[model samples]
Target: MDIRPIRTDRLSDKIVNQMIQMMREGNLKSGDKLPNEGMLAEQFGVSRGILREALTQLQAQGYIRRKPKDGTYIQDDIQSMLMNDSVNELLKKTTYSDLLDFRETLELKMVEKVIERASDEEIEEIIEGLGVADNEKVQHDMDHYFHYKLAQASKNIFFMNFIDTYYDLITEIAVKSNRDQVRRNQIAEEHLAIAKAISARDKEAAKNAVLHHMKMVDKTVIGEEGK
Candidate 1:
């Protein structure tokens, strides 16, 4: 059977994606002023009205800001707001297994990035900063804390923020299903292996460490098949 036409982006969303692309590519930097509406509309090949709609959404999402006369400029500190409320809400709809898969991938990439980009001092910092989240603190998650510090070491905001967004769900699960002291000790050692591997700049070891940790999580939380 032939497939029907795929759903395409709404015109305004297409425009919005282009601008966000520009920002991602460094063509548009935070605190940089934008061209006037007429010129921007011409550049985007869209009606001024449609461009305005896209801009309105960006402004609401913390991507841009307006002034009485200075027109629009990129937000001065945009990185922290990269994962806005809308994306966070969408992330909420994912299943626990889906989240486990995502977490495994994100942490592995973070380890790789940390190995590649972090300074020696940064590596040491990461090694020392493996925070022990006291399970007694119902609000804290030991697992999330360890991985988040690794994310920071990776020096990639997008990855770091995704891990940060993941914290609430991890904490919720931890609170609902308390592990025994034996499991906690095992995970803590797994985390230590990850940090040691990262400090040694041994990518394969780091990958193995992360995989083992995820496997333990998968078995206990989502079962062997992650179903």
Candidate 2:
């Protein structure tokens, strides 16, 4: 247990990163109890409050679980935590176009899986979800819900979590891009195209629809940024 001292700005974040690194390197294993807060604070050369903040973050992110009347322990599901953290960090650094590109990749793959794995009922559920956004008025929440249902139709846990993690960020970009009725209608129509293609079981068409939609999103977001 060679926990290094953290003497940097954002001390809590540094501590969190070091703990994650330790877990990755097998220096920390699942079910291993964390050293007492006082000892950890002393080892890291940080105040107890800072170390507590880092522990709080770790608990929130599912990297560790804190038990009342007990100690903090490493969570068993380390991979999911790592994936979530990685996705969040990547999104923070991404520009509009970068996010659009990453989204396009994930969405295209997701729809393909949906086409392969979704039940007829699941497909209909997706179409029904799209109907929520079918109105002439643009509802950001409805739009986000439709895409989230689309991700669910993929029947992949990882895809579902990935979408869940980024949904808010995606919605923010959409809010910036959807400046008027025309753009909103265009986005609605794009979702309709994707739903229709998937319902018809046309994988190629679904892929094309998603690609077109992503390009439109990219253009809209970039255009908004230029303003």
Candidate 3:
């Protein structure tokens, strides 16, 4: 009810963030209908076109569902919506090489941070995460869990959010590259090595481990593409 007027250069982004925050704070509940474009735009002191653009972005991000002749409603399963949308958007915009490069950059920094910041218990938790992929029934879910745990071990909220946001894309690439049993086993081994390096608080070793793992992933994905 306390919607403030927007005056920033990035009006649409600000609007989207404000709406998302409102939803998070329970001011807007699931199934609640958003005000019509004109009314809401007026309330925000923005042009209707800007409001529409923000609404479209929100819809794309799965925050709201727009129906024909009806209002936009909050999504019931916000987390799923976000994950699916994030992956879909990444898939639309990036190539395999791009994804790999971004992931390598993120993970290398993440491991270094973990070595510098993570507690003993957090390191143990990261090691425990590797157990997920050690099973005979190793799956993409396990890979996602392991990487997520590693990112969390970095003790940086920004790193955690970046990993969590693009996790589906990361897991998709892992699943594709891991179809071969040999590659799967190699990946599991790499995860364990990375976990151990982090546990030892060896920043250089951890960085090396991550870089090697990413190289293997890149090779696997590209080799598969060629085949």
Candidate 4:
């Protein structure tokens, strides 16, 4: 059998992963103080230096906070903003085609939730600012308004973050494509109609609007060269 010794240099990352696993298992929780370095090093079968390095990394990442007088405790708000930092990095490898696929597949959930759960007042907030979509001065600004606010109105923080994460690319495509004013006008009207459908709580209209919008978006910029 082939065998190799474990590399000590990677222990710090391993410690972080182990602790994160414990957190996920609920054995550790928000605002709970971590053990002293020596004890933690012993528990993880590592030296104190490795444990300290892991703790420092966690503190830097906003997963924990160190109090000079007290000790290190899990950050109180970690649950709400679970960014999944490593997982999100995979977005770096994503293509515009992949982005279009995400819109085509996942955004239906967003519309459905907004229709079922959002208040009339919350829905009104997004559509109100959309103004005349073809208005040359504010049209670009209004593009993000409808989608971003509607994501917020979905009442799902995870969905909101997902949309927020990819939204920059969405805007990038729009900015590049809308250099042609006619295309810009069409996009503005489409987004306005879609937002209004959601505001009216018309599920069929909202879905058709979203799919139609994506069809236009797919046909616009973002060629294979850009990917």
Best by lDDT: 2
TM-score of each candidate? 0.62, 0.79, 0.60, 0.71
Per-residue lDDT over 1-227 for candidate 1, one digit per residue giving the tens place of the 0 to 100 score: 99899897888999888888777777888899999999999988999999999999999877999997779999987654553654677778987788889989888888999999988897787667554444534323666666777888788877777888887766656544434556666766888899899889999999999999889877777542343
Backbone clashes in model 4, listed as residue pairs = none
Badly placed stretches (over 4 Å) of model 4 are: 1-32, 37-57, 76-83, 131-141, 169-174, 223-227
Best-first order by lDDT: 2, 3, 1, 4
How many steric clashes between backbone atoms does each model show?
0, 0, 0, 0
Tens-place lDDT per residue, model 4, 88-169, is: 6666578878877886676778888899989988877777775544443355566666677878888887776677667665
Q: By TM-score, how accurate is candidate 1?
A: 0.62
Q: Which model scores highest in TM-score?
A: 2
Worst 10 residues of 4 by lDDT: 131-140
Candidate 2 global CA lDDT score: 0.81
Q: Report the C-alpha lDDT of model 3 over 1-227, residue by residue, as the tens digit.
A: 99989875589998998988787677888788889889999999999999999999999877899998988889888755555555666655887788788888989889988888889998887776664343333656677778878778777766666666565555555566667777667777898999998888888988899999889878987876676
Ranking by TM-score: 2, 4, 1, 3
- Stretches of candidate 1 exceeding 4 Å from the true structure: 1-86, 131-139, 223-227
Better of 1 and 2 by lDDT: 2
Worst 10 residues of 1 by lDDT: 131-140
- Lowest lDDT sum, 10 consecutive residues, model 3, at 131-140
TM-score of 2: 0.79
- The collision pairs in model 2 are none
